[model samples]
Target: MTQQPTNESRLERGKRALAEIDGEAGHNVVAALADIAPDFATYLFEFPFGDIYCRPGLDLRSREISTIAALTAMGNASPQLKVHIEAGLNVGLTREEITEIIMQMAVYAGFPAALNGLFAAKEVFARRG
Candidate 1:
């Protein structure tokens, strides 16, 4: 019998990514969207986690930092921000380090956005405790 290609499928990659990034968090997010938009959740898994996040250049901790920063800058993605905050901690970012990242954003993203991010971080920290 001929051997199959060693390359993995998107779903397999996505499952691996999910385990690394935020297995339960991503699962809950996708599960919540299953009824309303199943395809949307699949894309969330396939694209962000499988394709983008798994790329080796940035390491998981750095990725979460950038993700937290971007979501914090958006000033409207608190829910997602909260998830990334938890993700940051999972990847070994200390509580103070995460706080500093958000605080430093105040210079460019403005006080309101920084404050919102801080609140999101606070909530995440509380939950983890």
Candidate 2:
């Protein structure tokens, strides 16, 4: 987990990381891209999960927090936001922690974005129940 094995390809490393972080939801996102942009799925796996997420500087929980914050700020990435919110939970983020993180975004991302993020969180939470 510390380093990508020398023998593994980026795709392999990414797939492993994606499974660890996003689980089924991550696989679904990649699968959905199969018909339209298969290469994009490879890119998504390689760059974010493989290259960035595997870095040891931040733990998975911290990474998910950052991701949740960024997606919430974007305000238009509800689908991505929901996926990451679930990912956040997968990586040990509590519902309270997730709610607080989105609420804090209101200062910078505005109330609308925060509200949207909260609603997305609500949906994910409801589904998990």
Candidate 3:
């Protein structure tokens, strides 16, 4: 099996992967990416979404949950993390599960990221209303 690259330099991949799951959110992610690196979002559209997100191995719900966990683990990504939290909810991850996940992250990702994740989750929850 070939190992996939986790290097975020592949912006189009990120955009594409994210777009597959949530097109509007993917575009918003691109907008956010503009603040960091303009070219990055372009690749996200191609690689991550087009290649990874469209893959048949994992279901959307599982992928979204995994993404939420991964983002929480990365830390210092309140904005993107929030997006994933919303994605998680959209995919049917319950609030209890989300809170539990965030709580679990506190041990590995530290208190700050976990706390921030909870706050981000709250924001996403509010937006749903």
Please tell me which predicted candidate would have the highest lDDT against the true structure: 2
For all predicted structures, in order, the TM-scores are 0.92, 0.96, 0.74
Between candidates 1 and 2, name the one with more favorable lDDT. 2
Q: Write the per-residue lDDT of candidate 3 for residues 1-129, one digit (tens) a residue.
A: 123356644454455456546657657877887888977766666666656766678877788778887788888888778877777776678988988888788999899888888888888888777
lDDT of 1 by residue, 4-35 (tens): 13596766677677777775777888899999
Judged by lDDT against the true structure, how good is candidate 2?
A: 0.94
* Error of model 1, residue 21, in angstroms: 1.2
Residue 128 accuracy (lDDT) in model 1: 85
Query: What overall lDDT, based on C-alpha atoms, would model 3 receive against the true structure?
Result: 0.73
